[model samples]
Structures are given as structure tokens and as C-alpha cells.
Target: MTSSLMRKGSRPLRLPLLIAALAFSGAAAHAEDEPGSLPRSFPVATPAVAALPAAPTLGADIAGLLEQARASNPGFAAQRAETAAARERTDSAGALPDPNFQVELMDFTNQMRGGGTTLVPGRVGETRYRVIQALPGWGKRDLQTRSAAAKAEQAAAGLDAAWLDLALTIKQAWLRYYAADREAALARESLALLGGLEEATLARYRQGLVPQQAVLRAQREITTQRIAQVGIGQRRRGAAAALNGILARSPDAPLAAPAEPAALPSALDLPALIARARAANPAITADERGIDAARLERERTFADRYPDYSVGVTNNRARGENQTWDVMFEVMIPLQQSARRAREREATQMLAAADARREATASRLAGELGSAWSTFTSAQETRRLIRGTLLPQAQATRDASRAAFETGRVDFDAVLEAERQLVDTRTSLLQAEIEARTALFEIEKLVGETP
Candidate 1:
């Protein structure tokens, strides 16, 4: 039975091997049929070394950067274009309708049969020409133009909002890059100090004053600091790249550090902040314009239920003959009640939706303002703590630990630990400062500060 089972398994394996052999033979034959053919892979560039010029950094101030971003950002530029188009549409809404021209040449006969005798026709062709134009009903053009103008104003406000958003993003990116630069510097400083400690430990060990273990520990710390410096440098580079990207630079562009801030306001009153935000916030203005647009649209659409009238003159001339003119009036009746009804309903729905959106936007803005205020407050508190208490205490501890270690009072490990603590405290202080600046930026952006 065992021999039979082995034979069955071996038979199946032979069939697979035969199939594999067939596939391999087919592949070999195909390769031989195609002479001097490279295997499929990524295509080589037609021109080697597509050297591109290094992109220039704007190195512009915050205001100038915001302006550049406004021009470069697709969203902001598109909104600006849309606003201009809407303005043109508003003008068109108030313009007169196109005129229509008509001409007709009536019968001109060379001869007329009168009592079986040929007679020339005395009166020739009667030619008529008319210019027809549709004159809008009273206030119709005004209403239509008003509606379009309101929409255009809304678009302008929308552009302002886009600008605000781009400015906020730029500010955040700049602050982050600045923080990365500072952190890199700190890491380098720490590495240098660790190197000095490492050398001192080796010298003491050589003098038979410290153990080999102490020297090895200091060496390890220096190595770790070097590694940290490398990582921090990479982070700084990444941050710089991001800042350049925000300014619409190519990947290879070099961006200068952001300008240092002179100072920040110590405190901002909540009432004043809210009032300024209300005055400058594009979202609120957009909502207001939207309301106006919806109201005008409703009125205009209702007015459409009535008929419009036109008046023009008709003229006729043939072969430089005397011209003839006829004055006439025309009126179109709105007989499609269903279409009118649908338009009114559509306008009503749009108006309601706009109002609802406005309410929602107001609610959302309030929440955002509250959060921003809280964050700014908390960051301020953190900065105060770091400056007045935490950093100074950490610095004192590190100094005392170093002195004690020098006097053979404390171990080298304790001194290293104090140094690490001091570094951590300083790092935290930098972080808090960055957070405070970022929070201020957010609050100002939400409040629509220009710079």
C-alpha cells in the first residue's frame, strides 16, 4: 500500500514537471525568435542629465509671501478670476437685448397683361426693413443686475477667505521651519559639550583617576549625541523643503529663514478680538452677500412671471429709392405657469439653504474662536512657566551636578543625568515658545489680521 501511494504522488509530480518543461521550452523559443530585443523595463530618458536650474527662493517678508501665494495658489487665483467673470455677468444683466433686423422685397414686374396688351408696372417692389429689440419690463434689468452683483460680491469675499487660509498655512510652515533650525542648533551644541566630556573622561582615565567604564560611558554619550544631531539636521532639511514648497518653489530650491518677529502683543481683549473678527472675517461677509443674492434672485425670478416688451422701426428701400419707416411695439406673454412656478420654488429653496449655511458658518466660527483663545492662553502660561521656573531650575541643577562631580562628590553618571535633564528642559522651552507663536498665528488668521 505504501509503494502504491508513493507511485501515485510521484505520477502527479511528473505531470507538473512536464508542464514546467513545456513552458520553459516555449519561453526559450520565443527569446530565440526575437533577436536583439531588450527585456521590458523602464524606458531610458532620451536626453541624459536633464539639468534643471535651481529654483529661486522669494525670501519675501510675510506680507509679500502672502501676496505671492495668493497669485500662485490655484484656488485663490481661480476665485479671483471667478469674481471678475461674475462682475462682467452683472454688467451683461443690465445691458439691452440684441436688436433684430428684417428686410423684404415685394413683387416688381417688368410687364403686366392688361386687356391682352403688355403694360409696364408703374409701382415697383415694396421693401421693408425693421430693427427689433426686446425692452425689459420696469425694474427687471435692475433686479437681475443686483442679483449678479450680489453674487460677485460674495465671490470677492470668498477670495478674501482663500487669502486668509493661505496666509495661515504659510505662517505655520515658517514657524515649524524656524523651530527645526533652532532644534538643530541645540543638537549641535549638545554634541559639542558631550565631545568635551568624553575627552575629559579619557584624560582622567589615563591619569588613573577614573575607571575605563566611565570613559566608555562618556564616549557612548558622545556617539548618541552625534546620531541625534544627524537626525535633527534631516528634520531641519525637511522643514525647509516644506516651507519652500508652500512658497511654490521646486524641490531643489533653497529658502532663507523666516524673518525674526520683533515682539507679540502681551494680551488681546476678547471683545475687541471678536469685534475685529466680525468686521474682517470673509466668511461672515460672504454669508451676508449670499443672503442679498438670494433675496434678489427670488425677486428677479418672480418678476420673470410677467411679460417683457419691445419697440422698433421698420424701413424699406430699393435701388436707392426713398426709404420707408414704420414704428411698432411688441409684447411677450408669460403663458408657461409651470416653468414660473418651478423657478420661484427653486429660488426659495436656494434662499433657505443659503440662510442655513450662514447660521452653520457662524456657529463653526464661534467654536474655532473659542478654541483659538484657549490655546493662546495655555501657550502663554507654558512660556511663563518655562522662563520663570522650569528652565532656570534645570540649569541650576545641571551646574550643581557638574560642580559636585568635579569635587569627587557625585558620580559621573549623576552628572550626565543632570545634563540630560537640562537639555530636555531647554528643548521643552523651545517647544513652548513655538507653540505660543503658532497659537498667535492661528488666532490672528481667524481674526483676519493682514500680516
Candidate 2:
């Protein structure tokens, strides 16, 4: 009984091998009967190089856009207005205070003469018309003028800073828009390639040269590319909206395609850039102006210790008496010593704070420049490597895999993976390009490059 059971199990195992052998033989016979029925290789699709948009002339388009933004952006306009207002304030800061005019009816009741009170100045015992001018302490006006001038300088520097910031933002936004636009174009190109592959795969499926799964995979890839294209389109629109917002345009406004960015200036060594920042960076300049203003304010505070005076001329008229002129002078006494001392201390602290702020701004800008320089160099190297080495390699691998798939030497998954790798490498190159340009723009902003 045990031998009988073992024989039954062995027969079941041998039956599968026999059937498999026959099926292989039948497939071989079928292939032999239909000569040249299967495709030996599929057409290799060559993708375009992942490059930025071409320009006939570098920097012209972007420069014009920046100028438009500067001219139309409301925020920048407000900043310019603020600077103008500050300049106007400097003119009035040192001007003399308005003079005081006084009309006095001395002894209006005339009690000493036993007369009734009178509201009329002419009927009073004595009427005086006085004009008085208060004078600030020595050197106070000059110090105030200098302080106001410094403040005006600070405002001008602030305007410069605003412009730098806006320019940087505009540059970055433009770059983002360019990258998205290019990526969308690439996606469309990829989709077209995939569509061809899908058609070829369906033909192979119909001929029974390849499995149905291959056709499904090709179709899936085409669909996925379409999905990615949708995403890229969304990103492109978002970037366009941001750029349009910067230019004070409607979100849905049409825009020209972006051109390639200009190369960095030949003189833009790191050390030279740092020097430029020191000399031209608006934040540092503003801080320096703040220090000057604070120093002048401190001096003016100390000058407050000196007394201010007022001079007056009076025209006196008395009833039944000749008109007379009187000259008067008054001096201000600085009696609040504690308050004045506190103010002096406050001014001193403010001056020190301003000095500290300048140092801090310089240090911070140096660190930012260093970071941007590092990023710029790294992105440039990455882009070069991808463009020169990785992109070509990926494309070659994809073509080889596709050929192998057609000849039945490799699986369909390998071909799909190769395509994905090629796409990813191209994307990485695009990102690297964007990063390098963005870092360059950051450096320009740090150095306060004007439009």
C-alpha cells in the first residue's frame, strides 16, 4: 500500500515536467514555422539634452523684466517714497522753532488805580505786544542737522536694500518659472517617447512575441508620464503666478518664455565679492549711517546740558502815557540733572548698540556669502558631472535595455527602470542648473548689485 501511494505522488510530479517540455517544443515549432515574424529590435528613442531655454542675447530679457518690476511694484514704490520723505525731513530738522507772539494786558482790572476790570487790551492800564524767539544751545543746530542728514542717508540705504531684496526675489522667481517651464517641456517630450514605446509594445503583444504584461507596463508608463505632466503643469502655473505677483501683474497674465541667465561677472571672485559687500551692501551701509546718527544724537544729548535762551522785543502802551519799547531776554535753566543724565546714558547706549549692529550685520553677511559661494560651486560641479557623464550614461543604458528587451535578452522591467533612471538624471541636471543660478543671484544680492 505504501509503494502504491509513493508511485501515485511521483507520477503527479513527472506529469508537470512532461507538459512543460511539450509546451517548449510547441513554441519552438511555432517560431520555426513563422520566419521573421518577431521584431528583432525596437527603435531606440533619443531624448533631447536637458538644457535651459536658449537666448540670442544673455541678460536682456531678464534685465527688462527686472526694470518693469522696479517700475511697477507697489512695495518698491512705497519704499522710494519713504526715502523721499526722509530727505524732506532733513531740511526742516535744523530750522528754527516757530516764534511765540504774546499780547499781555497788565493789571487788566486796574485794582491799583481802583478801576473796573476790562476785557479790551486798549482800555487796560497797560498793553504789551511781545515777539519772542527761542534759541537752541551752542552747536545744537549743527549737530541736529548732521543727525538728520545721517538719518536721511540711512533711509537712502534702506531704499537700496529694498531694491536688492526685490531684485533677488524677482530673479529667483524667474528662475523657478524657467525651470518649471523647461521641466514641463521635458515631460511632454518624454510622454511622446513613451507613446511610441506603447504602440510598439502593443504590436509585439498582438504578434505574440512579447507577453501581455509588457504592453500593460508600457501603457502604464505612458499614463504615469501624463500624470507627471499634469503635476509639472501645475508647478509651472504656480511659478508663473509668483513671478507675475512680483511684477504687479494679474496671476493669470500671459508671460514670455524665460531665456538662459547670463554668466557670472568675470570679476566676481569670492574675495572681490566680499569687498563689494563691504562697500556697497545696503544693510551694512544703513548700519553705518545709524552709527553716525547715534553718535551725533549722543553729542546733541550732551549739548543739552548747556542752557538755551530766548530773546523778546515788547511794544508797551499805557493809558495817557507815551508808547515805549522794551527788550527782554530769558535763559533756560537745566535743573533736571537726573533726567538729563539718564538721557545721556541712553544716548551712549544707543550709540554702542548702533556700532554693535553694524558689526553684526557685517558678520552675518559674510557668513551668508560664504554659504552661497559654497552652494554655487557645488551646484556647478554637479551640473557639469550630470551633463557630461551621468546623462549620457543613462541614455546609453536605456537604449541598450530597450534593445535587449526586443531581443528577449532582458525583462521589460529592466527597460522601464532604465527609462526612469534617464528621466531622473535629466531632472537632477535641471535642478542643479537652477540651484547654481539661484546661488549666483544670492551672491549678487549680498553685494547689492543694482538692476
The candidate that wins on lDDT is 2
In Å, residue 54's CA in model 1 sits off its true spot by 17
Per residue, candidate 2 scores C-alpha lDDT tens digits across 1-451 of 5564356536434657869999998787777554655433445455697997654332235787788887899999999999999999898988899999999998899886678999798788999999999999899999999999999999999999999999998888888888888898789878877787778677778888889988888888888888888888898889888978887888887777777667644224788888899998999999999999999999999999999999999999987689899999999999999999999999999999999999999989999999999889888889889989999999999999988977878877888898889889999998988888899999989988887
State model 2's lDDT: 0.86
Per-residue lDDT over 250-350 for candidate 1, one digit per residue giving the tens place of the 0 to 100 score:
75576665566657666667667777777878888899899999999999889987889999898766433677668999999899999899999999999
State the weakest 10-residue window (summed lDDT) of model 1. Answer: 110-119
Regions more than 4 Å wrong, model 1: 1-61, 67-75, 103-128, 316-324
TM-score of 2: 0.84
Estimated TM-score for each candidate:
0.77, 0.84
